[model samples]
Target: MDPAVRMVFKNMTTDLAEQYPALVEPAKLILKKCNGLPLAIVTIGGFLADQPTKTAAEWRKLNEHISVELDMNPKFEVIKTVLMKSYDGLPYYLKSCFLYMSIFPEDRNVSRRRLAYRWIAEGYARDKATADRYFMELVERSMILPTQQSVCSIQGFDSCQLHDLIRDISIAESMEENLVFRLEEGCSSNTHGAVRHLAISSNWEGDERELESTVELSRIRSLTVFGKWKPFYISDKMRFLRVLDLEGTEGLRNHHLEHIGELLHLRFLSLRGCHEIFYLPDSVGNLRQLETLDIKGTGIAMLPRTTIKLSKLCYLHAGSGSGDNEKTYFSKCEDICEMQRDLCVGCCSLDLSDLDGFGRCEAFHLVCCLMYPNIIRGIEDSGVKVPRGTRKLKALRTLRYVHLAWGIAIIKEIKGLTGLQKLGVVGINKKNGPGFCSAISSLSHLESLSVRSGDGLNGCLDGMYTAPENLQSLKLSGSLEKLPEWIKGLQNLVKLRLELSKLSGNLETMQVLGKLQNLSILGLWDDGFKIDVLRFQTGLFRRLMVLDLFYSRMEIKLVEFEEESMPNLELLTLSLGDTEIAFSGLELLQSIKEVRLSVHSYLFGTPKSSKNGGNEKMGKTLYEMMKREEERNKPMQDKVRQELQAQLDRNKNRPVLKVQ
Candidate 1:
């Protein structure tokens, strides 16, 4: 049992026993059946306690409802009954927020602020006044328990979690009530299917027969299908649909999407992982009101010819993936890459071909295919001329994964795109000059800047480009052999990540990063060798909250440091490299509420006392102590410890150390 759960149930049980004496015994039995499940205890227990009638008939009806409504999932029937009873007791306004959670995926953790935001988005609550009040009301009633311990200072709610079982139950009830839909099983419904809003899984292959049944989908307004589905034809009957989500269904062949142009009213069409869907029929230009089109995984080998006509299209994820199935279209930028509207080219090599027809684009991601020469040829063949002044890209704000191979050419051409706010790219070429770096540093609104590492090329980042002043988050990975001095200039950086390194993190770089006042999450992985100086400099990270250091080669003992340095730190991870590292003070990391220690170090000395030894009882007691430490979150820790101590006392007269 989780310690948090034990505390919650113990208090709730005691309160119910005093207030609702009649159902207290039965409630205890039900809570025991829950096995300390938090969601069940809070939601169901709260509902049951508020019931106006505890008569035999009402209780029987509740149990019957559980047996029937929760028949498919018997494992959590008790929990479902608890929630059903509680839901019946809820006021009309609170019920709305609780039911709205079904909109999120099952077992997903939701923050109170985000949930409130979504409620506002859905117009469920008129304003923050009603939404916030309802959220607090739920917390006060103990219907939605807070997942975190309130530290008096933390304002508002940070995060909340529903028991996985309860989440599933909520989703089931919501799906039945038509609030949401999750197509886990095979799609058996025809166009006349009763489902209002649909979220289908394309991860599992559907029968071709499913398409035949989709002919009457005219009434369906919104549809979300997983991107992994093999290219399948969309029925012409889906004319009434407004939103079509094909996220992660990369297998949509050109012919499979022929009917998309017919849905003229379609406002949002997401092809997030449609990497293989290389061609969009010119018919797509007919969607005059199409607001968003996401083709995140569409790795265009070259530009397409017909995209130039999409006047109202605001978003597109037309980028390639790193796989054999990767697909790219060949066309000019004016004709393909840069339509008459905004295009979101995710992970696709940017080919500034056919720039003549270019229009103002809101955003573009150049993180794909950093290999320059091949992409350049594709751009040239498209006949899109790159003028000295590319005015159309001026409004762009975010750029990511731009390959450094074409860094010089692109920077020179797209210098007019001065509105960038977030940028992620690699700098490996000697030709990457101060002007290119300056061009990047000019974007004042830039909040997140990530640099690609130069692994095989050491000393490549000696004095890299100076970062923009507004940069708040910086992530470095994949062969960043050394830290450059220019990083210190980005004083506003709040979150930093250094992953997959080769003997990096020297003292100079650490000292510069340690001074950043707003730094929050810091993740470092030094697989090659240990640099212990950074570990002791915990005080330098004054405002750091979360720290993760993995697979280090350091020789220091992890248990020596006290937690007083990280006053605001909440989570800490220490991966030990040597057996001499003691974990005695691990429980004393004052500020740290949660700690994860990996025991990779080898255990030294002969067996303390194997089961084959004379002091068998002593060996068992020690084994129990080790097990308790391994399962640290056990709710009955005190009782378990006392039991082990008694066993140890009984074995005190035996040999303390006996050879196997």
Candidate 2:
């Protein structure tokens, strides 16, 4: 049994420790039926946990019945029954959503975004964000299990899977309800009744003919093609479909999309991993009712102007989610917003080539301005152009990834979205000057602002810019000569990040930052300071908890926190070179909890080859190329090991160190 499952087993057997001692031997046999599944273990454990005596006698009675069922029914319907209880316990709204998961293969990791979109299309929830709650409920009930990363992340888990044993029950229940069917190529099975939804299982090569024969295609409202089966053209007869998920379908091209517009009721359409596609047909813009459009990794570089007509579309994961992971996080800002309103707006992303159509974002919520200049040029060269008419978005609270290179005219256009609370823009310079900063001050409601002026390029803010008093987080890059004076007025500032290499060596610059009474976390990157020593003045940084310092151009050899400075400091992350610094500052921090030191050293080296046939310029033979590389550990390694040993020997006599 896996350790986690074994721990659950131990916790369950606690009730029988004393009274049903002899029955434990029999209980182990019964537990084997669970196959070490946490769901099964937890389910059976709950049954024992509620026993009147919590004794072996009660467990023994349950065990005997389970034993008889196991012997008479090899499938161990007893365990299946326990799993079914969880499924049956689901709320009315979540039942359909849970069963829908049965379409996916067992042990397959399902994308949370994919589920959110599909669930919304199926009318399981009002929108994509609402549907996310339904998924979390299932995992909470132990009906599904989450991956490791999901559990550790502060961000909610994005994927989950079902145990094989649990999957079997879900499949059986799904079939019994006639809710959906799992179709495969070789399997010659047909659904008995009206199949409302169908999942063409992965590895299925059968085409449209196989689909028509197995199910009444017209009645199916939702169709999900998981693997490589290509339905060149969907039938016009399947009219009621509100959801068409072709996530991993192969060879979806211009012709495949010709009839898509006819499905008037379609709400969700996905082509997330369809790498075969290089361009999308203009007809895709006809799905006016479309709520979510995901083409995250598709090779298609530009979208048609017709997409601007999708007024119903709110969430658009249009470009590389990885290229700008930080910029793409549009939800975090919305979630923490203390203000809430029943407002509506639509957002569209325009590449340089698709500039003919204008998009919308409203009520200070979200407006993603693509801020990279070179990227803007590439997109414009590809066919993206500016919209034909004036676009107004009064409700947008957030504007993300805005590229100022779109022209100052674009800035004037966005100035109308006065409600923006969060904004991230790049491509600023002496040419634009404080006009960008002056425009930023107009967003009085803005709480978070991020501006990046590319490498070696300087942007001057000066006194003309007005910093929003409510601003809580600010990230600034580029050749910022000094922190703008407006920063002193940001009484609500909570987080600050700076990345400018030409930072002045002045200590007063840092002292001013530390004076921010409400600031708790600070990150200094790319030679944030030109000084050799960073000294914290006493009575400053009273509430700061995390301080991250990275080294690139400028190197700091010493960091000293004055006696009363950083009274609540908890974590200090240091990126340093071999220049020796003092460890005494760490002792001065009254609330110091952890020290993460990334020692920068020149240790990694490719040893020079003495005997090499490649030196003759003919290059090495296949044998040499295929040969295992030699490992080198020399006097440096030995010296380091000896020093480490000496440090350990010195510490051995002292008190043991504890890690928090």
Candidate 3:
């Protein structure tokens, strides 16, 4: 074995002994079988560390079984052991969700929002929050590796993927349990016993025989079809079905949903990405047990007027995608070009006045107007409006993108939503600003709030005396002449995005924001702020991990960090906007892991003038200067890199952070 592999093995063995001293011998045996494969060893070790009982006898048994399986399947010995052990260790609640991953296509990112809702609808968990916990557990165990989990951590969109080995094992185990029946192109379902859940993949085109003759359709509990198929009248026979996910089905006209009321047990229905579903039947109101109704990215402009009957519904997604942008792992579903005009719910005159039955709903998400204000004007001009009576949803927790026409009545109703944890809306004007400010203060449970003000957010903040104590994430986009007085009170704020703020003066508000101990990410976009000389005070922003001020090149010219300021900051982004950096006491702070500078202007001919002064220009960003004279950005960039590198080398533990 290579020296590197040997060192890793030795280090891993020592860690295992520390974690489970009693099972060290069995761990050694497992590691021997792994042959220094780090993934298996680390995964298995983590798994054992979480075990309820760490008896040596039980581990010896597991070790012996793994060794025997390795000999039998020499091709994929280590991975099989790790996967099988992981599956066996899962609690009963997570077992089903683990198996359900096999339903998605190979190498596809499983949507966190989509899957969590499915689990809630399928009665796998009590509610959406419970289902989310199950997902977090899987992620913690490494069974599901989330794509860009950190990118959207603040936004709450956690999508993930299953490794191929884990995927295959899930598929095989699902078949053995008779929990899922995957219908392939020429394959027929086994009618030997009752198969409860069935899925038709995109590549499969099974004939009618595969559904009617092979399996008893009435016994099916879940039917998920991701293919080109006509399931127009199939709901009549699947009376016992609880979940009908037709997200990718085509040509689904009103006839498809006409008889949907017959399935009394149906709880979850998905029409996302369905191009042919122009209209829905009134029978949709009959699913009193339904928990989730996903019509996102579909051609359905209007829902059945009797939608109030679904009193049990908790999650309703009516938007193609939200405006709260974050780079996720999954690709957006292919658009149905034929129904493009009428498909988006935002562009239509959707009068959402009669959804009073959504009183029990926890999450009510609609594309109120994540679109630009100009696009919204062109779309919602013809009387499309989000009506009043949302206060009726006392149980509501997440209400997003509501185009509140801005009045006393609307603001009063909003104040009644005391249980709200997350909310997003296109705000009202000055006439209703007082009421809106009062309402914002009343909702004490708000953890995440996103407001896109049509008439400037300053009006809404005018009367605000206090911020939500628990508010952690906030996104505000609009004109801002002054900082909100309530902002300093939000000590729990973790992520904040302030857009289009023309801030200036003594930088008092910036200092207040810097003192927030829990702040993790801060983004200042176009027209954010203008300060001549920005200085960081020591002992401020101690818990910040990502500080993103890299915007509007030339807007900020000079910045200096005092020692002990931002001691834990891992990522710092600065827009070289018309200004250069002056590092003060930078050598004292050695915890910085990365520094990103977006330089838009710097003169090469005058290096001394560039450092001693500020010169705004347009040219190639990264270019080399004469070898003896100086590098293109020798005054700032090259020197800064060299100093940081020296600090990192002296620390020994900190690796050289990538500078871009």
Judged by TM-score, which candidate is best? 3
- lDDT value, residue 119 of candidate 2: 87
Ranking by lDDT: 3, 2, 1
* Model with the higher lDDT, candidate 2 or 3: 3
Against the true structure, candidate 2 reaches a TM-score of: 0.60
What digit string (tens of lDDT, one per residue) describes model 2 on residues 473-544? 887765566667778777798888776635533576777887898988777766434466677778888878
Q: Write the per-residue lDDT of candidate 1 for residues 496-520, one digit (tens) a residue.
A: 8775554334656666777788887
**Estimated TM-score for each candidate:** 0.56, 0.60, 0.67
lDDT to native, each model: 0.52, 0.60, 0.63
> Model 2: residues >4 Å from true position, as ranges?
1-78, 103-105, 108-114, 127-139, 148-158, 163-175, 184-189, 192-198, 219-238, 244-260, 273-280, 298-302, 321-377, 380-403, 416-457, 460-660
Candidates' RMSD to native: 13.8, 12.5, 12.9
Error of 1 at 185 (Å): 4.6
| Model 3 alpha-carbon miss at residue 491, Å | 2.8
Question: Ten consecutive residues with minimal summed lDDT in candidate 1?
Answer: 321-330
Per-residue CA lDDT of candidate 3, range 1-660, in tens?
346878877887787678768767887776765544567666556666667887999778767665344346454366677668999999999999989887777667778887887887677887767988998898777677676444325644468877655666787888788877777665655573577787777777666765676667777888888767665326467888888888867655545576788888888888877754545667887888876777765645335556656666555554333432221111111222222354354435554556442211101123323333333332232111223454655655665544444235556666887887877655444656677778888898889887665356666667879878999998776667777778888889999877655542236767888877788887765543556766777777778777666444334544667777777776666554334445444455547665565444333243322332223221222223323333344466565566556655554336444565
